[model samples]
Target chain A: MSATNLNWRAIAAIYRFEMARFFRTAGQSLATPVITTSLYFVVFGAAIGGRMGEIDGVGYGAFIVPGLIMLSVLTESLNNAAFGIYFPRWTGTSYELLSAPVSPFEIVSGYVGAAATKSVILGLVILATASLFVPIQILHPLWMIGFLALTALSFCLFGFITGIWAQSWEQLQVIPMLVITPLTFLGGAFYSIDMLPGVWKTVALFNPIVYLVSGFRWAFYGNADVAVGISLAATLGFLVACLGVVWWIFRTGYRLKP
Target chain B: MRPILELDGLTKTYASGLQALKPTTLAIREGEIFALLGPNGAGKTTLIGLICGLLRPSGGVVRVAGLDIVEDYRRARSLIGLVPQELATEMFETPFAAMNFSRGLFGRPPDHALVERLLRELSLWDKRKDRIQTLSGGMKRRVMIAKALAHEPRLLFLDEPTAGVDVELRRDMWALVRRLRDTGVTVILTTHYIEEAEEMADRIGVIDKGRLILVEDKATLMRKLGSKQLTVQLQERLEAVPEALARWRLTLKDDGHALEYRFDTQAEENGIPALLRQLHELGIGLKDLATEQSSLEDIFVSLTRKAA
Candidate 1:
C-alpha cells in the first residue's frame, strides 16, 4: 500500500501550493461551473421542465441534477488537474518539484487531491444552485458523496495523464473538448438512456460516462438504468486504469524528464 | 577530504538519440567551489539536471553523501539544492511563500526564522511580501537562490546563476556564494563567462561536445595553461617581420604596426630582453611596449580549440 514512505509534509506542501493557486484565481475557476450549470438549469430545468413534467417518475428539473453535477465534476476535474500539473511544466517550475525529496505518490496525491477537492466543492455549489430551480431529495447522501469523490479522483488522474501527455496548451484542450464533452452530452446528462431506442440505448452503454452519471443519478433518485453495483464497479475499473497510466508515466519518467 | 558527490560513468542519451552526457565520471570534494565551464551545446545544464534528479540517466549510477541517487533518491535529493539556468514559474505568489513551500517540498518542517534569515541573506527580506511578478529581474534571481537554500542543503548546484541578472546581483551572488562556502556548504556552478568561474571557483571542469574534457584545480589549470603576451607598437609599419628577427618567431599584427610575442609565464628567462636587444639592433624603432597575462579565457579557447 505504501509505495515509498509517505512524506506527509511534502504532500501537504504541494497540496497547499496547488490549493493556494486555485484560490488565487478562485473567482474564475469556481465561476465556470456556477455559470454553466445556471445556464443548464435555465435551458434544461425550466424551459424543458415546463414542457415535460418527469422522466422515469422523477421531475424533469430534478432528473438532471446528478447528471449536471457529474458533467461539471468530470470536466472540472480534468481542467483543474490538467492545468495544475501542466502549468508547472509550462513554467519550468516542475524542475524544482521533481528535484525535491517528494516521491511520485506524493506528487500525484497533491495534484489529484487538489483537483478532487475543487471538484467536490464545485459539485456542491452547483447542487445548491440546482436546488433553487428543482426541489431535490437525496435517497442516499452517503453514496452520493462516495460517487462524487470517486468520480473526481478518477477523472483527475485522467487529467494528470493528459497534462503529461500534452506538449502544448492546444493539446490540453483536445480530449476534454473533443472527446469528453461529446461523450458526456450523449451519455444522458439531460435525458435517460432508457428513453432511447434499443440500438441507441445499447450504444449509450458503450460510453463510460454513462456509468458515472447513472451511478451518481442512482445516488439521488434511487433508480438507475444500470445496476448500482455495476456502475460502481465500472467507476472503480476506470479509476484503476487511470492510476495505472499515471504509474506508467512516473516509472518511465515520460514527459516529466528530459 | 571526503567526497560529497560522485558519478560513475553516468550517461544520458535522450530518446531522440542525442547523447547529452557521455559516461561522465567525476567527484566533488566537500566544501569546495567547483565551476563547470562550457559553451552553449556543452551539456552543462544536462549534467546539473541529472544530479538534481530532474532527468533520468540512461545508464550508470550517482551517489550523493553515500546515497545512491535512484535507490535512495529522496535522501540524496534532500541533501542537494538546484538553481536552474532559468526558471519559468508563477509570479503570483510571494517570495516568502515560495521559500516556505520549497523547504516543505524537501520534507522540512516550516522554519519561519530560517526562512527570514535566508531572505535576509539573499537581500530579499524587505520585499518578501511583494508578488514575484512585480519584482525586478535581479530580485527574482535572488528569490531563486533563497528558494534553493530554504532546505539548508549541503550541496547546491547553480546553473548559469547570473545569465540574465544585472551586474549588482551578479556581484552580490558571488559574495553570497563565498559566504556560503565559508559556512562549509559546497557550491557547484556552470558559466559561459570565464571570468565568473575565474573569480569564484577553486576547481574547474571544462565540458565540450558532451564530454568532460578536463577537470583541474583552478590554480593548477591556470598555472599549466597560463602564458604571457608582449605587444610592441612599432614606430612605423613593417611589411613583414625582418628575416633577421625570424629566430624570435614574432608575428607582425595591426597591419604590421605592432609586433606580438607569446611566452611561458613560469619560464626562468622569457628572452624578452634578448628580443628587445635584437629589435633595437635591427633598427626596429619601438613606439611602445607592454606585457599582459593570458586570462582564463585564452586558456579555455586553446584547450577547447576545434581540430583544424
Candidate 2:
C-alpha cells in the first residue's frame, strides 16, 4: 500500500453502499426524477408546445427535451450527492468512514462516482421518457453522452462539496432549491434565451446553466446559443472549482473531523 | 520485544482552545489487555480518536504495529480496528454485508469465511441476514464489534465498549475481548468502569484531565496502593487500645470491640503474627478475625479525585 496508491476496494465498497441505499428506495429514488421530468415534458413540451409554434426550426416540444433533461440532471445530481454525504454525517456514520484505511481521495471518488452514476441513469431515463411524447433526434450521439456525463459528473462534484459544507439538512437544500433550480429554470430549460429581449438575453448569458443547457441542447439539435467550446470550458472550470473545494474540505477536515 | 503500539508526545488541543489531551507517551505490548481507565471528559476517547485517525492530533505521533499512524497511515490504519463509542452508519445494511464492506475498506479481499466466523463469534450469525435496524440495541452493538473484527486488525481499540450494555452482554463482551487477546491481538479499551478494568485488564492506565496519571500492572497497582486491612474482634470490649499494642497502629472501632490493622500487601512484613504475639503478651484475647482488601473502584475514585 504505497502512500499515493489507489484503493479500488474501498471506493467500490463505498460506492456499493451508497448504491444499495438507492436500491432500497429504488422506486422513490428513480421515480422522482423520471416522473418530474416526464411531467415537465407533458406540461411544457406537449400542453404548452401545442399552444406555441416551433422555435429555431425545431418543434417547441422537441426543443425543450434537452433543456428538460438538463433540468432534471442538474437538480438530481446535486440532490443525490448532497444527501448521500449528508446522511452519513448526520447519522455519525462518517466516523467509520474517516477512521477506515481509506484515503480522502478514495472516499470522495466513491461518493462522487455513485452520485454521478445515479444522476446519469436518471438523465437517460428522462430522455427516454421524453422521446415518447416528442420526436427526438440527437445529431451527435457521442457528444450527447459525453456532455451528459460531464454535466452530471461536474454537478455531482458540486453536490459533494455542498454536502460537506452544509451543517444542517436545511442548508443542503438552500443551494439546490434556491440557487440551482431557479438558475436552471431561468437558463432556458423551459424556453430558449433567444425569446428574451436584448437586456434579458445578455443577462441570461451570465447564468452558468445556460452554457450547460446550450451545450447539451446543441448535442441534440446541432445548434447552441453559446459556443460549444465555451460551454465545455465553463463546465470544466466549474468542475475544477468543485474539485478544489473538495480537496480543501478533506485536507482541513472541515466539518468531517472534530 | 518491540511494542505493538507506541504514542510519542501525542497531544490534542482542539480548535476551541481546549487541550483535550496533553503530551502523552505510552507503549502497548502485543497480546496484552491494556485498560485505559478514566472518568468522563478525561481524554480517554480523545486518545483513542487520535490513534484511530478520527481526530487529528494537535501534536505528536502514533505508531501501530510498527507503522507511523500519520506517515504510514495506510498500513498503520489497516492494522488497527476501532469499536467506536457510537454505532456506525449502515443501519440498513446486514451485519454480514457491513462487515464485508468494512473489511474491504481496509483493502482486504473478500473472505466470506472470515465474515461468517466473525458474525458467529459475535453471536450475530443467526441475525446475519437481518438489517441492523431490525436488531435490538444490544444486538446492534454486537454488529459493531463484528464489523470491527472483520479486518482482523492486530491492534483493536474499544472505546467504552460496554457503556450501556446489560450485565450479561458486558460479561460476554469481556470474554470475547479476552479471546481476541489470546489470539495475539493487542486490545486497548477505555472504560470509566473500575470493575471492568479490574476484572479484564492485565495492565491498567489511569488518565485524567488530559494527563496519564498512572499506568501499572493490575496486581502491582493494587499492591502499590497497599489496601489490605485486617479487623480483629476481642472477646471483651476494651476502654481503649492498650499502649503495649501501639506499635501496630491499630484503630479501635465498634466501641473498642474491633481493632483494625492496616498493612501493605507488597511489604516484606505484614506484622500480623508479631501483632498477635504482642496482643497475647498484653493479655488481649480475640473472639474472631476478619480481613478485607480495597477494590479497584476505590483506587480509581481516589486517584481521579486526588488528581482533580
Top lDDT model: 1
- Compute the lDDT of residue A111 as modeled in candidate 2: 91
DockQ in order: 0.78, 0.74
- Report the error of model 1 at residue A140, Å: 1.3
CAPRI grade of model 2: medium
Please give the lDDT score at residue B204 for candidate 1.
97
**lDDT per residue (tens digit) for residues A186-252 in model 2:** 9998788989999999999999999999999999999799899999999999899988988898889
Report the Cα lDDT for candidate 1.
0.91
Q: Pick the candidate with the highest DockQ.
A: 1
Clashing pairs in 2: none
Model 1, A15-85: lDDT tens digits are 99989988988999788789888898899877777898688899988999999999999999998899999
Instruction: Compute the TM-score of each model's chain A versus the native chain A and list the values.
Output: 0.97, 0.96
In model 1, how large is the Cα lDDT of residue A63? 94
